[model samples]
Target: MEAKGDGSAEADKADFQKMIQGMLEKAKQLKPEELVFRYKGVLYPSVPSSVQTLQALGNFQARPEDLVISSYPKCGFNWVNLLLRDIAFINQNESEDGKPGVRSQLKLLEFENAGNYEEMKNDPSPRIYGMHGHYNNLPSSIHQKKTKILVVFRNPKDNAVSYYHFCQNNPLLPTFSSWDEFFRNYMTGEVCWGSYFDHALVWEKHFDDENVKIVTYEELKENLAKGVQSIAEFFGLSLSEEQIQKIAGRGTFQAMSDNAEKTHSSFGKVIFRKGVVGDWKTLFTKEQSEEMDAKFEACLAGTKIGAMLKYDLYCKE
Candidate 1:
């Protein structure tokens, strides 16, 4: 049994190395801008995602029972995705087969191939799709069906810092020479998925909509158990207190980080790095901090979503 396990581990390691090599080769073929394709004024990474997929997003059909997780990049997307999957799995009474099935099973609507949209259209009820796009760009059917949409956002300062590190590590994204340069691009909506503020403001308009639930990353971090319970309730799933506690404990940064290899494969480390609040303080200069603050004031201040972020508590030093 030990020998078989060792052999399987070695094969997994080899497969991960090959995947990285393929990404590096693909990166070599394209300029930084070519790494992403622009559609409807939003930049999407072109690696696993295609322009054709984005174009077909509008016509895609959505069922009323469908659930959508929408967020800009690096905004606790993985964390929420995992938690929801666990909730769904437990609700269904599915047994864990000891495989990293949850991450592998989830699909990003924007990143899927255009041809796959047809497959998704025919998929059965209780479907969940993840996406990063402007609120207006989602399938019109979603609105018509009143599909539940969970909009997860983070404070901009920490979001920017996390995004910078993510871009540096992921070959699918363009790298910057310095944080200052990246900060400038980030402020101007030059990064993948466009300006964070633009995305937030649009989603904020729908906060009162019955189908839309606004969740902030900081709130999840501060009280994950409570957050998980709220999310379960939003999804109309009833869970015992014990189940909620277990999900919360497993969903912490350290627990998820430790299990990333199994859940996320080689990309796990890159995706799960330092899931902490206020890391921006280590990297942001006084001026950069002020600039982000001013942008927040101009765009999100006094908005319902802005209050949800608790900006003074999380972003301010």
Candidate 2:
């Protein structure tokens, strides 16, 4: 009886320490105002990637061979996460030989275990990772290594709509009840990730490097087979074309949304919701589209992105 009590007491102490630590960390991070974090743009404050090294946030411990998926929010992050999840890790399929009951998906790839950047570095064997971080926030070391980066960019109009729902459901953001308030903040780049224009530009510039490759969410949606091939090649993974097609088919926007619903959230909503590319058609007014285009032109100026984007004309559906 005494020993059990002692064990409970130790657990309580550890929990208390964790609570206090979390509070202190939160205190250190700048307050979110109008959705933009004051000291945050690409750089984030102490956000731990793992329980082991809880405070070494944002710093990259990258090597050249590592694979990083960088995307703006609502830009196929979950799709890529699920894709890399399958490619990078596999479970022992009920082999007659006993292994632990089953493996948690977390143990499969590098991203599952990492709560922040630091933990992303601690994985084994050609590690794969994901982040919503803007271009400037990435570590210089990672850049110098010429680490293989897969960047996913989506049209900002749709991103804005998706981000609105995400923030509404996200506990961390100061919730605004009205779309009017949300759109104002979003247009001004006052939210967590900042101006979608600036963020996308940074990523586009990075793709100029040999090791960096850009993929569009629209392209991925239209033809996931090719998207899978592009990403797989970027990470130096070769698979048969047929196998790649299979992966693309399985990791669809609809499938992920349906699968995520069964999950119970300790946080606000289930992290993965609808993955459709252009719910914005229903949401964006003509004036809003024009206003959004002004930002796009300025950010995408001097690039051939305009023609490519014109041809694809995503979000029409």
Candidate 3:
């Protein structure tokens, strides 16, 4: 939002102030250990105030047309965003500004902007919102209204590594001096937005729910056309093969990187680091890799999600 030349400088700054104000209020109430909360035996990177906020969110009012895109930090949230926008705008006339989504239409649950929330609350139907909240922390309205929810998850190995670099670059989060420190914090769920395992597994329980849909980052990356088609189908959007191809083309890493304004805005450039699968291999040492594997095995031994997510800490190629 500092503008640095993305063109939306003034507006970005205002929204950033709101986000910072929200985070500071939560930060003010944090105890040394309360920087993260342990709920249901899983650690979450939320302070006491946010925990209260999460409880309050249980009463949040949601509309039937609202769609919540949920995921842990750095776990393909942006990719899903781009894909969703492309799906929605594929055959339609492009915006006059040539942006992805209507700037005023976007909403975020994790980093709430008071201005944006007011706008979103009064906005038209079929509003799309993004959040990194765990399933238990989501609004009760989500279940009550049966508002369509899409959970996009990535392999934890890649997720952790991606998050480590993200912390180093993003001003909002604490920067780590080394990958070792970052990995230790991540394994213990000390980073912002909480544990990837908890976020994914909690949402996994709702995979069978009629209003919920889950997609893996690996599957999306492996065959984006198929991924786009599956997402379109889930969202009940109709598109032909040509349209699907167009969406996939524009949603690619290179294309999105080239058009950051349309893809990611307000500190989003830093969010667009290496968009690849299995980059964790370069970052993780043998011992760390084995440790993560053990943790994953122990945490997800009998859960279907272990396989559903294709959980392999050490992936070659």
Specify the highest-TM-score model's number: 1
Q: Native-vs-model 1 lDDT?
A: 0.82
Q: lDDT (CA) for every model shown?
A: 0.82, 0.58, 0.69
For each candidate, how many residue pairs have backbone atoms clashing (under 3 Å)? Answer: 0, 4, 0
TM-score of each: 0.90, 0.73, 0.80
lDDT of 3 by residue, 111-138 (tens): 4433334455775555667777877777
TM-score of 3: 0.80
The full ranking of all candidates by lDDT, starting with the best, is 1, 3, 2
Candidate 2's residue-wise lDDT over 1-317, tens digit each? Answer: 00111334344344434543553356446454422323433322223222232123334467887767777767766667667655543221222432222111222122222344435446465765656667676656677788878777777777788888876775445667677687887888766656777776676666578877777777778888887777777776776765676667666777655554222112213356666766777668787777777767667756644444542376443
Model 1 weakest 10-residue run by lDDT: 1-10
Decide which is better by TM-score, 1 or 2. 1
Off by over 4 Å in 1: 1-24, 94-103
Candidate 1, 1-317: lDDT as tens digits: 00111335455555555655676688789998789888777778887677777777778888888878999999988889888888776776745652223433446787666667777767666777878786888889989989999889998999999999999999889899999999999999999999999999999889899999999899898899999999999989888897888889888988989988776667778889999998999899999999999999999999999999999999998
- Candidate numbers, best TM-score first, in rank order: 1, 3, 2
* Candidate 2 or 1, higher lDDT: 1
